[model samples]
Target: MSQPPKTQHASIPEPLAHPETRGIELIQATQRHGRARDLFPVWAAPNVSVLNFTVGASLILLGLELWQAFVVIIIGSLPWILTGIVATSGPAAGTSGSVITRAIYGIRGNRVVVAFFGWFISAVFLALNWLASSFMGAELLGQFGFTDPVLAPVLVTIVVAAVTVLVAVFGHGLILRSYPAVASVLLAIFLLVTAFVLPHAQWGYVAPEPLEGAPLWSAMTIGFAILASTPLSYTNSPDLARYLPESTKPSRIIAATALGGALPCIFFTAAGALMATGIDAVAMDLGIESALLALLPAWLGPIFVVGVIINTIALNGMTTYTASMAFQSIGVPIRRIPSAVVVGAIGTALTIYLVMSTSLLDAVNLMLQLLVLISGPTMAVFATDVILRRNRYSGAELFDEDPGSPFWYNGGWHVPGLLAVVLGAASASLFLTNPAWTGPIAAAMGLVDLSVPVSLLVTAGIYIALTRLAAKRRPGVLPAVENAAA
Candidate 1:
């Protein structure tokens, strides 16, 4: 049973109701009572579609065995390489991560930091991918004696972003339609090329010694880092989930969805591992290029490079789509930029900048580190709240904006939120080796002096105690507050 609410404030406005602005209704549900009915669907096609785009391209990056990539792949990625899959039994949205922050730090448990920072990270990723794809595309043509790389990358990025934006704006059906055609052909090419190049690979370097100090752990971390986007992958799941007719088992949906996305990691890592040993890693930075040079005669390399370009485009489209969602999550409030236009334009700009900047490698590392650091405590709290607190997410109250809700911390920002976040940030800054924001996150974690798993434990414990104390005190003070309100 729910308690009668305190009087609603006259100042606050309801969420804007615009037909044009849509939610990630990727799940099938209707607005009934207080709770939204539709659980996010774990669909197969969208999952696979995203997988083909994301994992397929990721394998291509595996070709660039930069830093510890090779060591990570060889040691901990045994299962992934064998199957090329990254399954998802965990929470989808960075929701877990988001919850941790809300429960502990930020606006009395109203932590929108996940959405805020995640959008930035995803935006940067989109930019990087667009930059890489466009730059690489231009280079492919330039290598053969085309023209200027600068103009080509920039122009091409704009064009590609434009196309991607169109799809995102129109509908999901259009995006799904292209997946089979593009992913199937690319998968075939990737396989056929791998089949041919297998013989050419230098068998001697297949398994280099494990990373210098902690090979297994480092390897697993690297492998896991590659799938860093896994939790955030729920952005689109909402779209696909919306269609499952509400009766579908979300857990089953998640399993199947993860399976589709994960399958490519096996072959992709394998392809990367095999090539890392066989060819100069940099020279084979482009998988198809390596496969072409290794297996096919020299002349055919260009043709397949074109296919790689297509594959890149398909995935870039997904990147563009996700980027738009991230932007819309923020941009809608500030102004009224169309999600499509925002995604495409910003994507193009960021991509070109990152691709040209050479510092992008640093950028990527920083992004991943932040995601992990933030995700740790976040997932913990969310999981606990879902399983322990409400049984199954009975309700969520954005208490920061609307203090009348049941969960409201009732003031500006809660003390626990500020303290927990500071601690987490400090710990992350100290422990994590990556630069930029990573150091701060490690520092954040260090401030708390808890391992991610343990820090999560500590964070949850602290918050639970804090919330209970608040609840116990609330009833005693209500009469006075009510009298004051009257």
Candidate 2:
């Protein structure tokens, strides 16, 4: 691997001490600080949400037995490992994942994916999380006898959006410093929730009329896809890891990122599954809040609401922070703070519409199921690029935009990389099964959704083969152009 260029340490403000004013710029070696372990809370605090509980419960509703649901949760959570591997690029490249894509898809070509996958998808997630938080916030208010339905939702939306956007606008420093405490508080509340909910679980619960053969397999695949979508959607892991020093070991980064996220995700999701066994599947169909609140004592209700809202802010804070970088990466001539405010404004609007016009439970299920088709291929291409270059990148060269720049191949587009993504997403669509639409192949195959694996394999295979062939024609292309900084 090529070494990052040596430069005198820049006198940047300590990220933990002040607002991170930087955008997508390269971080000098001296500017880099923080250990790999610090990333644990950064990733963990965000996953401690009721969304995981809903996903876990959906497995039982889909006809899986309790043991089967546990197996699915473990398998589905494996995508965090892929997410961790992608994070190694941040320290190696000394820049956010949004900028690193210039190396894979070229400057202009990258804008398309970055805009769609990075900005648009992230904005949608911001709205979804904000909506979740607003629901919980309103429920908390209702307990206080503030039950004016119209007035309650509006008030909750404002409070949730304000807290989330402010943290994001403050940027990286505050996030890192605050997440450990956030994670601890959320974890404690969830453990208390677990204590009250688990005893009511039917440990050996089975579906009243168990699905058989192809139907069973199809249900399992869909369930796995739903559970995996949360981790797979996070192609921005590198955004958080970008400030870590280059000397940070790859194994440490990968372990901390993967374990931190996967452990809580599995635990809470399984807790949801356990909770599902005790409730009427019909009652859960209403929403996680009603189902869960019915089981908890009145005193724990307010505490549970607090945990949900805190987790939402943590989740949306990370999304908005990364989405701002993505907006800049799209060639927008905007700074970080303004971009975050714009994202927040848009998310708040969407949250209000979702609250008034649609069922939150239905929207969540459909969005997650469809998201995997695009997110799986996008993440696969990024992980494949990181491996091909041996995690070597030039933070400065990635910023280069001239025609002579190494990344400006074939008129600012890496044809092979772009082709791989297009083909991979198209192929995955043929096997996708969701409420919006079922893919032809999936319909033919008794509704089995194989979109996740199909997308990853197809995207990775094409990129590797094409990248190697291109390297044969151009000697210095394979190992990342020797990192001009080196």
Candidate 3:
């Protein structure tokens, strides 16, 4: 509530109902005050979406036993390590995640990454959730004897999109405030779902017919890829964490984020696997809605539908919020609200068409596979840059458009960072496998998809080595923090 510490960046414009004047500017220290632990609920709330339950169901279908599938899921969750670590940079950088990447990739180079991983990828997520929710909304209506199938989903999408856009327009403060209530309700719903299902699960410790040779390995690889690659879609977590006080320790933040993100994911994923044990996993092709409708008690079915609908709205709020931040990072002459509106509109239209014409799960899976290629390298580049050059950000230099600014390298692009991303993406492309396309190298290499892991290693190694060499040779190619105390 109090005014923040003085900074050269322009004063933030006060909002009538919600916080405003955020996007690409340094959040002053006074504004940077919140408990690190609160992030757990906020981060955890969005993971309750239908996609997560599908992920659990997916692993079982991949030929893993119930316990084996769950274990593999735990293994896939390692990407949250970077997710939590990157969030700690929010206070120090006093900016959104995409803007902070300028410290590694330079101002112009950051735009490239933002366009692909930030805007495009975010739009993909927003659309997928929108499609799922619309169908679920229609199904819920049908249960009440409103049998106009065509009319139901179309009307539901309009309402959902409008609400999500309004919330996103309010931006960070409102989004954070809404999470606790949402998360509590979501947690209770999943707990009920889990409690009801686990007792009835007939799955054995091992699959009835175990997968053999390359089929088994490839299936396991895809399962891990799905789990690990999940975090790639959320690389902009620092955009939310930027509101936290600079004094918040990274360790505390990381622990909160990890638990918040992992717990809901594990519970729902396991529920999906359990659902598969009773009914055919293939019947769950429609994702969480199908799984829930098929699995939940008849009396509780309406509640499950409502929970999923609410979950979709909450997820879209975060997606649109982060996408707005990514839009600002693009160096465009657009404000945050307008950017969010435009993206939300396009995603809504796309979702409506896909819901009417195609399979949402198939589309989502393809997008996620592509995300593995893009997000893996993007995270690797950003994380590696932070580790190699900690405390080396110049808050002013991040917004510096001048070629001579510390963040500006080789005509406003960091060549080494760009090179690393390109190489990492190309490497990932070789091993990518999805419904629409499979990588030639992945098929050749025993059909094993090592895209995320390979991309992470290759990008991190190249970035760290090149950055160190550049720093040594140029004697200050990367910027350092202006404040010694900082």
Candidate numbers, best TM-score first, in rank order:
2, 3, 1
Q: Per-residue lDDT of 345-442 in model 1, one digit per residue for the tens?
A: 76677777765664323444345445545544444444334333322221132212345543344553555544554464445345454434334443
lDDT of each: 0.43, 0.85, 0.76
- Greater-lDDT candidate between 2 and 3: 2
lDDT of residue 196 for candidate 2:
98
* Candidate 3: segments with Cα more than 4 A from true spot: 1-16, 148-150, 205-208, 285-288, 479-486
lDDT of 2 at 465: 81
lDDT of model 3 at position 401: 72
Best by lDDT: 2
Writing each residue's lDDT as its tens digit, candidate 2 over 309-384 gives 8999999999989888887887899999888889899888888888886655676878888888778888899998
Clashes (backbone N, CA, C under 3 Å), per candidate, total: 47, 0, 0
Worst 10 residues of 2 by lDDT: 477-486
| Model 2 ranges with Cα > 4 A deviation | 1-3, 6-18, 479-486
Better of 1 and 2 by lDDT: 2
